[model samples]
Target: MTDLAGHEGAWREFRAALASPRMHHAWMLTGLKGLGKGQFARAAAAELVAEPGIPQPPAEAHPDILIPEHPPENKDEAKKREDGGEYRRKRAIPIEEIRTLIQRLHTRPTLGSRRAVIIDPADDLERNAANALLKALEEPPAGTYFLLVTHRPGRLLPTIRSRCRVLRFNPLDHAAMERILRESAPQAEAAARAAAIAAAEGSPGAALDFVDQDLGRLHQVMLRLIAEGDEHFALRGELAEEIGTRPDRERQQAAVDLARAVVAAELGRGDARRNQAVIQVHGDLVRLSGQLPTYNFDPALVVMEIGALLASLAMPREAA
Candidate 1:
């Protein structure tokens, strides 16, 4: 397992739990997105199943560890194509997936005395799936440890939340973020790295994503447009074309996120009217961006809509 960065406190807590005579079977790992909560869960699971004097196998090769059938980050939605079908994007952990995991937990561990069940981002669980998982957590099989990763703990059932010990993961510090960036993207340009670090706001995963997709350039464009209003539609069209033309969901998400960040950076300026306008656009962006996944809206149209909202911030109060 890769060493998790900027989470030493969490590691120490987990290790202490392991060293205890009676370890908690269920642990809730809560944090913002891309803070390595899932990675920590996997490492902890590996520790549970690890034996003395034996080499640790990769997560997938371990028989005693179980993860969600479809990890949220990698899950895709199948779109009907003329040729047949192709996956685009999808989200959700269904009841059947949970049931399968539960059934497997009932069996004895294949490799060790303990088994590890990991639900990456338990927030993605459907209502029925969450209930089914709640039952497992309630009466987990002996020698079984459940590591639930949740970016939004509030969304989980109160009963489920009550059953497990919660470990909060905070954003990484600048030093930790830099160390991770060096390890993850050794060849990235200095400018790109700087942009990613600033834009990531202490999330290594988000930073890496920005670097991998070359989103720093897009972020710069957003900042420039926000700073200097696009009197003509030229800048907006260019940005929209760059993001909307690509079918990659990650790129689209990054664009929306960057735009929101740019607008949010303008908050708390001396001008109250401009601050209110920025606040409104930020909220609108959040709502509209959400619909992209739920309604499968056209990415181009969405970018245009975001552009329009952002453009409003550049307008003078006198013109309003």
Candidate 2:
């Protein structure tokens, strides 16, 4: 469990829940990506599995632990529907799967003090699956625990969120990020340490992304856009296209982080022009962040929309 980075005070939170006369059946462990929600759930699971005399859960084999992933068993049905062959399997976690998980929870644990089911990114659950989960949350089996980890807790069924205890996990601090960077890349410790501290934005897991060496380029680009601004059509377009092609949602967030960094750097310089550019671009980033969850938005549209906004910021303006 030491391997899980960026989450502190997890044990305290867990103990608080346990101390209650009646622990909530469900828990919404919400945080941004790579903040160790899964690890926290696992640690909680260990406690649930730990017998009165046992110090820890059974590491080798634990019947009380359950972790479900995406792309449900009926994913073939989803592909068929997408291809227009058959209309079926509309979402990631299906009702039947949730029912099965529920059914398993009905019985006493084969081994351990209690039973626990961890649904990582529980927001991915289909509407029907979520409804089924809601029922279980309403009438939970005694001694059973439901740990739902999600980056987008807002997407979950409102009823589900209301019934559960919510625990928020904040990102890592500079010292933590530096320690992680040092352990991962000793050879580049100095540079990695600095970049991780800068790019982390309070998440140690994000620090690893800097190892790809793109952090410098990212910093340079944001610097120019915030300072000199970019009138070069090709240069602006190039950056847009590159961002458009990045599929990882977190990278999109990182782009937003880069915008925030631009704001910070420009504000410190006290250059009115750069400050104005930073403010405008930061607004654009806020817009883009809101748009990211829509699956139907074209990558090009995203790029062009934000790119045009960035391009407009290049123009020198009179003080307001």
Candidate 3:
């Protein structure tokens, strides 16, 4: 239960629930990406499984607490080069994991009177897996608690949503974000930190990403390209080559995110025609970003297209 910034209200609500005679068996912690919903879920679960007057054990060591992982597949099979020597692609929480969790729930708590299960970003549960989990939520074992952390609650089964008490975690404000940044990124330069804060738009996790990846430099390059427009084809080519072919996945993601933020910021400015152009580019960026992972499109081509979209923003308006 480390210090969690920008979630005092949620903490208070949770404490009140614990104090109540009738506590909720299921809690859905919902919020945007990079917020601390997952952290809060783990902390709450730890509290539930801890023995009275004894020090709480780390999450990994607690028998009464479970956080489901992507169950291992094909243990006999050797790693493939295409798979980066391992299965690295995003995977869903399969039905086997939920079934196992449910089996464990039937047993008595190992330490405290309560047992806890945390499904982080429960959004990753496969369809069958989610259904299996739904059954447990509907008829949870006595003294068992489920904490489901989700960035998009809409993706969850309606029945699951109905069963859980939803706790909405809001984004961190400037002060809270600063406190987190100071602690997590103490060595980050003031300029880089400021840029990260501005680009994060209230998500301390995202701010940390910007600082850790030195995305502020990338962001400045993006701004320069936007300001200079399509006149510099070579510059665009270089920019595309740099991010598109990089082995660093984090840099690629940061670039796409920053690009969208820049275009979104431009949407409300200028006249109707210019605003429309910005809107179109913003939509394109969103679509492209989504498609990149699913379709496995060439990264360089995507970067080039993104550059073209930014260039379009600088196009001159025809005389009225």
Candidate 4:
């Protein structure tokens, strides 16, 4: 909940900005996923709603501390009813939503000394939506701030990015991750957490995916297959049944994704000294993912063809 950047300078800068009562109208947090972008955004917002050493705001979704909620007009806004679409759905934060948020910001704070809004992954804003938000940022209301968090700042409108103060968030050290893993997920082995760090590519939330039993099995199997060829065709039928029978569209896509990652890793065994192999397998991976909804490419066939192609790169003909 506290500023975890641990850099006294960044904290001082923010606190000084707060003292001046002129926090950046829009702050862009640029970083990789799971590096606590959302958590940091909430922390920044809470500075307005919930100060350090004080109790946290009753709920992060409180109206004064606005984080965009997706309600499709069928649900009550005050009660925060679910609109059937998950909160993470990729719909633009409508102009209407922004206008309502502005109305809330102008009202006297319900609890905290200040008011804040956070738009996670601000890069998701549609072109028109981004421009609309930019207009507001151009003339942000006094005593209110917007924390725009994202993994890809380059994807945001250049004009939008220019309007904000950019803060780059980096990953926590191994020790920090170990501490978090111990408290939050003791069931995970220390080594598992460490290995997950590698897979996360420096994202903490990403490593949490290892908690899934299915993904754990896949991660291990995937790594093994990458280092050593899985000559047995046993996994193909297993993969097919697992993928073909996924109950939801999301799970089905995840299965194709799992296969793609497995084969892609194998293809990248070296410094891509075998890049042709990597390219060929990457194309198959894309095809496999693309066809998950449209066609029924036998998963076994896909895996075998991928395996065979990678295997060929190691054959005697390529030795010359």
* Top of the candidates by TM-score: 1
User: Sorted on TM-score, highest at the top, how do the candidates line up?
Assistant: 1, 3, 2, 4
Q: Which ten residues in a row have the lowest lDDT in candidate 4?
A: 83-92
How high is each candidate's TM-score?
A: 0.85, 0.74, 0.84, 0.68
Residue pairs in collision within model 3: none
Each model's lDDT comes to: 0.80, 0.68, 0.79, 0.61
What TM-score number comes out for model 2?
0.74
Please write out the lDDT profile of model 3 over residues 192-227, one tens digit for every residue: 888888877777888898888777766776776767
Candidate that beats the other on TM-score, 2 or 4, i.e. the better one: 2
By lDDT rank, best first, the candidates go: 1, 3, 2, 4
Extract clashing residue pairs from model 4: none
Off by over 4 Å in 2: 1-6, 19-21, 52-61, 72-91, 187-189, 240-300, 309-320
Per-residue lDDT of 98 in model 1 = 91
Error of 2 at 231 (Å): 3.3
- Candidate closest to the true structure, highest lDDT: 1
How do the residues 163-182 of candidate 2 rate in per-residue lDDT, one tens digit apiece?
88888898777777777778
Q: Determine which window of 10 residues in candidate 1 has minimal summed lDDT.
A: 71-80
Off by over 4 Å in 3: 72-90, 231-235, 241-244, 271-295, 315-320
